[model samples]
Target: MRLTELPRTTSFRLALMFLALFGTCSLLLFAFVYWQTVGYMRRDQDEFLQRQLTFYSTLSPADRVQRLREHPRNDPGTRRPSGEFAANGQWLVGNLSVLPAELRQAHQPVDFVLPSAGAPVPFRGYATQLPDGHWLAVSQNVHEPREFEALLLRAMLSAGLLTLLFGLAGAVALGASSMRRIDAITLAIRRIVNGALTERLPVQGGSDDLNRLTREVNGMLDDLERLVHEVKGVCDGIAHDLRTPLTRVLGGLERAQRRASTVEEFRDAAARATEEIAALLKTFNALLRISELEAGARRAGFSDVALAQVLADVVDLYQPLAEEKNLTLQLSGTASPTDITLWGDASLLFDACANLIDNAIKFVPAGGHIEVRLDAEHRAISVTDNGPGIPASERKAVLNRFHRNEPSRSTPGNGLGLSLVAVIAHLHDMKIDITDAAPGCRVSLSWSAR
Candidate 1:
């Protein structure tokens, strides 16, 4: 990827955010260290000056003079450490030349300047009033803290520079690695879009967030590829199933136009064409309804549905048709009132069951039997028929729209009954299991309430 594109990636943006946060924390740390250093230095100075004043106040005048004599005398013209001054401002017998004008004759120490040999020095001192109209002052030297501050500042600057450089480099390195992974993901997606349904996003070794996302995306791709194939199959069905019926309609119309001598002959051809058109419309409607149900548009009407009631209703609705064909239609199930109900669209569930029962009635030979069972214990419904059963190999194929088995082609159905059942089951989060029922077929749809 281009350098300019790097910044546009999620990793680079997150790195920039990290850098900002790091800078903020660094500034706060620097401020805290500077404040603490200054406080420590001032505290040490205060304690030293207080001790000197306390010692000076304890001494007798004569002994105090001896102690003042011990103050450093090697540097001539330097300020004294201990001294006595008359109230009239004359230096009595200490190291200082005279009393500092700013040193109040009070117990607390105060800061002042003292003239020395070369440059004037900074000092802090305390003065106490004596019993004999004199002031005893004790002083301590205080070098300028700015010189030490300058040294500390230089050290901090060097360390801070190193930290910034290293942190930024690490951030960039991490961002680059993320970008590489993202690029791989993009390449994989591009290949998929180019008809490579078998392609999948690569998962790196660690189970990081990116890898988890890749795995989820790969799973979605699996479904998408299946749906794409299913759609292709549906398209193929449309071409295969609709073409013959549509051709019949067109051929009837052509025959009516060309070969029919009388109006009655033309009317007969037109009547046959109308029948084919109606069949086409039925198939079309069934496909549309399946799509609509699978899309979940009917879910808004959902409510608690009694499974037993739905099965009973399917039997009643198809009982007459079964009687007309000399077939026995029976509904048998056991359920407590509480256990019989499930959450679903009542109308849709009835329609699905009706379709299943209708298919059984149509497929079973005259005098054959069709059975509908509601298993409340398992949250399932099954329809079984005693006729020509579907082979195990064709069970799955028969669920696709317009897929007619070889023996059932002459039956009057658009071949969408079980396909509609599958769509309804899917919308209701149910599964369909098709199996041979000794003499015929049994198709059961089961639901998981939990």
Candidate 2:
């Protein structure tokens, strides 16, 4: 599936999880708050009742009885704070206080807690009769019972809904922001594949994973782009240089065929053309070999090759040429070096080392010195030459295809020497460095001991 779709679908599942967790937490909090509030209200009402009873107990017993006798009748149902008295309450109060039939049968004073039925519709109350044939009652109207519970449920539902809404909004905002960055990367990749070799992903200067991945992939793309450009330039140069000689050979043969007074002259011209064609074909073959090595298509042929042996072979092959040019060629290292083995195609490695040595001998003046040194500690091999060293600014460029310095333009060699070495190094997961060697240049090839 598309890259954008992957993240989009994952976010949908994450949102559902976020909602469920937040909703559960909210429900628990609502339950806790409601229990504490309602419970405290009930406890406060009970405490008030205790305080009133204490107040009544402080009165003298004789005064309490006199007040009960003198006070007018106060019906339980119609009593108000204004002390309004009922006209015919004597019998109702006497019967209720003196063990009325309902109380005698139940054998207890009437006590109940329930909502009031009138306009107030209070939460709780209690009713009873005093000892002296007088009715007494206590009631509390702190809140409406059903109405309060209904309102609480509505508020909880509203809060839960609002929480879900805000949570989803935040998730969507974060998801969209991240998606924009991914889209930018995707578009950049598409442009690069479509031949925009110079394209690069925008870096926002963060140390996050996405930024690191972008940087690494962009580095790889940079190498690929340079390789492709180099290949293109080499192909163009080959076509230009070979086309001239090929045209001349064809023209000469055509002229010989028309002007031939005998078969020998025509055959001689045909032989010269064939030789030129063979040279051109050889150059093309070499170019193809380098390309194949760079492409890593020969990786399957890799084996554990002794680095010292490879160096010995290359030095042996080039010593004669170096001596003819009046140059010193030396290969000096431990007889049985440690960590001298490398994993790679033996033939390709030999060819690459030969190219480096050949380039070194060609550039160095007569009687100049060349050495192939091995560093066991560093698992590295170096080919050094006493010549006009390459400038630091041009070291990397020289490793690219068809790159030639102006000073070496007169040299009878193609500029694919170090470039091929670099390709081989990359294929073997090794590193190649062209650095200053005091009055000359040193090319190092290093590999992992593991």
Candidate 3:
């Protein structure tokens, strides 16, 4: 967030490290090029000096002196000069007036300086001792090559400076970007911690790694918000639904204590209170079962279960209830009962199927028809009944605890049957769909291929 902190950021530090590494490599490469170029130029100068000395060696002394005198006149610039000298270091011919001390080594190349009219000039030359005890020296001035080397060094330095500047700027930009995103995320998290359940992390809308991580965190926030709301709703539902049964139990006992005149009257009041207490216990048990299923505790008892057989058993268990209400109950499938199977807890599946059948029997009119259908290829089972269908708007709500339709409020239930079914379906990795069967309601549970 601040300029002083930029260098401490990981992005900036990593960029600086790479820049340092690149700069080191560039320096090494430049040094190699400088070494090779200087070496090549000096080699070229040495070869030229050796060739000139060899030519003079093949000549007579008198002709060699003549050629040396003629060499300076052929090129008036005196860039290349040849001189004949005595063994005592006396300059005898050519434009050179003083023999350099570098000529002390016979038949070897050396570098030395000579004075010009304006400044001192550098030269590379070879000296050889003639058979007559005289000396032959040939040289070439190297001022331009030295200047070229200086120019190359300056250019490399300029390029390296510019690269360093640009690299630092890029590192700062990346660090600043990262810092801004982190600040936004921190602010959002603080807001959420302060009870802003809807707050979410910021996203830049790019497919970069940071953006992808932000999106995932936001999705998790969404789920957390939903769960918090569900927990609050469950608490409210528990308080409201349990209060009625408890009040009835208290009221029935109090009436018996106050006005019951005989043992029979007292027994009736006790029976009524017991029935309400039993219903309250049933509701609590159903809640615990749902919680257990949702926590995946039933998964340990999982095994291959014939779903068709479960449906048959459910139909048989609920057939007498349907008959007592003058309703028709039937079970049919697209495949053999033995062949339609699933991987789940058998008792849970049976309870879920039984709940669906019981609901159809309870709600359907007298003489109404109900069918339990199974589709093996699609791994689905459904119950269709000619009853007043659940409205589409309340379908999802009915799967929550203590949720009952207005028409079914007078029925004898705590409204946990479908909620239990939903938890069972979830434990088995199945989806429940409530759809209209034209004139009635159809509830289906399906699972994908494992």
Candidate 4:
């Protein structure tokens, strides 16, 4: 299968799975709680009746039976007893059917299962047998239970079921809403990859992860836009700069071949063509090098570097070149020696700094001044240069590969210097800015100081 056709990952699916698992666990927990609560409540009621039966056994058996029979009657002193009062606010009591021989032989409070009788409604009962062959029993009717407890259990189970249903629906709804936003952002990112650089993911501004992801994705698009525009400009420059010289060399060679008056002339034309091709090859090689650097494929080779030492060496190497161009180059600024180190590809940083110095020498006129300054700020090493300052409007524009100012349009250099600098800057999380100075331009390179 094509890479793009592979199943896409979704957070909503994972969220839904978790929600389902949570709901299952919650249902099991509710089931356990219901059974446990009902069991405990039943146990407490039965234990209370046992205690009352034991106390009632203290009375004469005849008196106990008389009380049970009269307890449910419509007497003037009719009152509800504590523990096991039925609906209509009365105790359930009556004589049971003939006891089995086993029950009769083992004389104690025994739970009996019997058929229903008139109002007594046979149930599991706890009883006590007196030594005198009389008996007293506390009957727990299965048909009629405590009204409030039964109602409460019913209500709780109903509420739990409703809550489970609503909770599942709410979870699904929330997952759907999040998934919609994510799908929208994914579509926008797909558009960007399809050459729509202006496409940006929407942000909800709630400081959520997706919002942060949107901003980060947009930032990536911006960087891609800059890189793409730079590549296009570089292609344009290769066509403009190389084509003219190559066309000239080709034409000269063709003319010399047509005449053939002297061998030296032919050789000169061929040599010039060879030189033009070599120059073209050099530009191509430089382009490939910059591309490789920008791709960060060689990051494994990076190492810790002394920022101050790198700056000092770069300034020294370019000083003579600056003198030849009739411009003064100087270095200023002091920072702690320990603070001047950075984690980076040292050779690349050196090349980047040298390129800045060369550009300064190339743009500044005779007697113009340039200074290379370095300092540690906010965990970064900064290098600033002074020369014919870049125009404010075109400061960003000049960073594009092959972009040159009107005045420097005729200057003899392909515009890859700053472009290479830009690649290194990005690799090291560095920032480079060209600003207009009082008299000339200033360039600054800032990288995270290790």
Q: Model 3, range 86-105, lDDT digits (tens) per residue? A: 98989899866677888666
- How badly does each model clash, as a count of residue pairs? 0, 0, 0, 6
CA shift at 322, candidate 2, in angstroms?
Answer: 1.2
Candidates 1 and 4, the one with greater TM-score = 4
Where does candidate 4 have its weakest 10-residue lDDT segment?
77-86
Q: Which one wins on lDDT?
A: 3
Q: Please report, as a residue range, the 10-residue window in candidate 1 with the lowest summed lDDT.
A: 71-80
In candidate 3, stretches whose alpha carbon ends up further than 4 angstroms from where it belongs are 25-82, 92-99, 102-122, 207-209, 323-341, 359-373, 381-395, 405-408, 432-444
Candidate 2 global Cα RMSD: 7.3
Candidate 3 or 2, higher TM-score:
3
Show model 1 residue runs off by greater than 4 Å. Answer: 68-163, 197-224, 248-274, 294-297, 319-330, 337-339, 342-344, 359-371, 384-398, 404-412, 429-442, 446-450
* Model 4 clashing residue pairs (backbone): 109-127, 379-449, 387-441, 388-441, 389-440, 389-441
lDDT order of candidates, top first: 3, 1, 2, 4
Regions of model 4 farther than 4 Å from truth = 1-20, 28-44, 60-125, 138-145, 182-195, 203-220, 255-275, 297-304, 307-309, 335-339, 376-386
lDDT of each: 0.81, 0.70, 0.87, 0.68
TM-scores for every candidate against the unseen true structure: 0.69, 0.69, 0.82, 0.75
Candidate 4, 349-403: lDDT as tens digits: 8998888888878877888787777665554444344555777888887777778
Error of 3 at 240 (Å): 2.0
